[model samples]
Target: MKVDKVASSPIPVSQLNQPAYPQTEQPQRPTSVRPQTTIEQAITATAADQLAQLPDIDAEKVTAVKNALARGELELDIHALSSAVMRFHTGHE
Candidate 1:
């Protein structure tokens, strides 16, 4: 939960006069960011478009379920469902 003051600062101020921080020596990582290749960027855009096209809710399935409920035809095998759910939660096949 630490913030990089140097990175987040509005402007890069010269710290030439300041004494070095007495922290443990670690290899410095490069801060420069490289641009993604055109193909990579295009693939990302295509993936995002595919995700956006997906329905928030499966409308046909929802309608079918609602109709079944209204007709009192919605049957649930409680024991089988419960066992399957329990097995799933316990990570047992």
Candidate 2:
């Protein structure tokens, strides 16, 4: 049976023995932050109102597409579809 030696660590032994420097001053941080409650509430309410105005689905369009697919009336361009998907994934316009 043969055995191979393990690779040595990349860091030098001298650097491992060095002492870390002490921090002289503490970093200043904000003690208190005031919340903008009214502004946040107004924004949330506006978003909710806009979302409520939107329809979940267009049933007429969905049914038409489904019927066309079932009847073999719809044709798909695979190359174009794949290109569009690639462009979307790569974030190209």
Candidate 3:
């Protein structure tokens, strides 16, 4: 009886010689230290300036407006209010 020969494969050596994969660069974000002020701060600042100008104004009305602005119950536009203030001052002069 005759026996048939089978072909055998050798292990690949290229994988052992391969260099490590290159690392990809990651995107960097900018670092900021300044803390952001809340909307309430802006509203309060504007309201304070308004209150300062109206020294004889009603305390209750000013307090109500300030509270409303701080709680977001009222919307305060500094630019518009400033313009109104300027107009009021000019009218008085």
Candidate 4:
């Protein structure tokens, strides 16, 4: 509780108001420089470009399949289809 008994601070009182080290100007990076693209990004862009060139749906193939189904030429393998679907959902071979 006595002021005379209190220990003095290790740092000088003058240094308390000022920074410990001098501030230096940092070099700025050039804004014109572009970041390099990763391999994954390049592959994805290539895939997207390839996909854009292809048709969304094969109309000719769809029409042929529809005609075949209507003619009863394409037999519906319900058991095999169900088994394949079950395997897909279960992640099994």
Q: lDDT for each of the candidates?
A: 0.84, 0.87, 0.83, 0.92
Over 4 Å off, model 2: 1-51
Model 3 — which ten-residue stretch has the worst lDDT? 6-15
Error of 2 at 1 (Å): 93
Per-residue lDDT for 3-93 in model 4, tens only?
5855888888898988879899999989899989999999999999999999999999999999998999998889898889989999773
In model 3, what is the error at residue 54, expressed in angstroms?
Answer: 15
User: Model 3: per-residue lDDT, tens digit, 62-82?
Assistant: 999899989999998888888
How does each model score on TM-score?
0.38, 0.36, 0.33, 0.52
Error of 1 at 14 (Å): 48
Instruction: Assess candidate 2 and give its lDDT.
Output: 0.87
Which residue window of length 10 is worst by lDDT in model 4?
A: 1-10
**Ranking of candidates on TM-score, top first:** 4, 1, 2, 3
Q: How well is each residue in 5-77 modelled by candidate 1, as lDDT tens digits?
A: 5656554466654668757789887799787679889999999999999999999999999999889898777
Better of 2 and 3 by lDDT: 2
Off by over 4 Å in 4: 1-10, 20-24, 73-93
Q: Considering every candidate listed, which one attains the maximal lDDT?
A: 4
Candidate 3 regions exceeding 4 Å error are: 1-55, 91-93
lDDT of 4: 0.92
Model 3 residue 3 CA deviation (Å) reads: 99
After superposing candidate 1 on the true structure, give the runs of residues whose Cα lies further than 4 Å from its correct spot: 1-41, 53-55, 72-74
Per-residue lDDT of model 2, residues 1-93, tens digit only: 998886887888888887788557887878887776798899999999999998899889999999998899998778888889989999763
Candidate 3: pairs in clash: none
